[model samples]
Target: MSGTELTVTLSGATAADARAVVRVLEPAFGQAKEEPPTSEDVTVHTARFEHDPADRAAEPAAGGPGHLSGAVTVTVQGAPEAVSMARESLAHAFTAQDQGSVSGDQEQEWQLLLEP
Candidate 1:
C-alpha cells in the first residue's frame, strides 16, 4: 500500500492541548504520540492509521482546547482511506472536545487549533 501524510498544525499550543488532540485520534489511527524536543512553546504529534486499497468505505475512528502558547502540529502518515478517516475523525474530535477550538473554514486541515 502507498503512504500519504496528513499534517495538522496547531499554533500557540501546550502539552495538554497536544494530548487532547491525540486522545481524539489514537483509537482509529492505532498510533498517536507526541514527538520529542517538546518545550513551553511548541509540541508536535504524529499519528498512524491503515486502510485497505480495494475497500473504499473503510471507516475508522478517532483535539482541542487551551490557549496556544506557540502551536501544535499533528501529522498523520497513512493510506488514502486512512487520511479520509482521520479528517472525519478530527471533525468528530472537534465537537467532542471542550478545549479544542476551530476557527475559519472547518472543512479543511488548518480549521482546528488548540485553545491553550
Candidate 2:
C-alpha cells in the first residue's frame, strides 16, 4: 500500500478540522507558489502524524458538529519512517514565508486539580 497515494482536500474543512490541519500546514505550502492573498484551498498530499500521540483522534469525536465522514486515521504503527516526512510537510504550511520563532512544547495535561 506504500505505493498508493491519497489526497486530502482541505477546502471545505470545518473550523475544528482547520485547527488540526494547521499542524501540517508548513510542509504543505513549501512547494506551492507564493501569490498575493493566500489560498485557504490547501491540500496536503503528504501528511505526517497519522496516529496522534495526544487523544489518538485527529478527527473530531463522534456526535460532534464537524465529524469527518469517510475519514480514516493513517496508522503509523507499521511504518515508523513516515513520521519525520509528515512533520516536514506540516512545517512548511505553518511557517509559510517566514521561519518564525518556533519554540513550544506539546503538553499532555492541562488540568488544575491541585495547586502547586
Candidate 3:
C-alpha cells in the first residue's frame, strides 16, 4: 500500500489526460485490500478539465472547443477501503479509458484530468 499521495497531471490535444489518470490509478484497485494503507485508506480519483477544474467533466465533450470542463469526485464502493479505492480506480480508468464512456460519448470528445 502506498500512503504517499500521488497526483499526476497530463495535458495534450487529445484525451491523453484521461488515459494518464486511469493508468496510474489501476494499481490501487488491482491490489489486495487486507493490508493497511490499502486502497480504502486514501486512494481516490478526481476528474476535471483545463478550463473548469471544479465540476465533473460533463457530457463527454458535446461538440466544441474553447471550453474545458469535466467531472471530478471521490469514489468509494461498499466493502473495505480497498473497495472504495477500487471504485475510484474504476471511476477514473472507466471514465475516459473504458470503451463504455469513450465509445458511448463519441459525438463530442474532451480531455480528462485525474488527481489523487
Instruction: Give lDDT tens digits, candidate 2, residues 1-40.
Output: 2221112233333334444443343232222122222334
Per-residue lDDT for 1-116 in model 1, tens only? 54344444444446556556655655555443334224556544433333344433356452333233444444433444455576567665553232332333222233343222
Steric clashes per prediction: 19, 13, 9
Stretches > 4 Å off in candidate 3: 1-14, 31-71, 83-116
**Predictions ranked by lDDT, top down?**
1, 3, 2
Tens digits of per-residue lDDT, candidate 3, 1-116, equal 22322222233312433344344343443222222221322333333211221232322222211222344332222223332243344444434332121112212222333233
Taking all chains together, each candidate's TM-score versus the true structure is 0.48, 0.22, 0.22
- The 10 consecutive residues of candidate 3 with the worst lDDT sum are 98-107
Worst 10 residues of 2 by lDDT: 107-116
Model 3 C-alpha lDDT versus the unseen true structure? 0.31
RMSD, one per candidate, in order? 7.2, 16.2, 15.5
lDDT of each: 0.46, 0.28, 0.31
TM-score for candidate 3, please give it.
Answer: 0.22
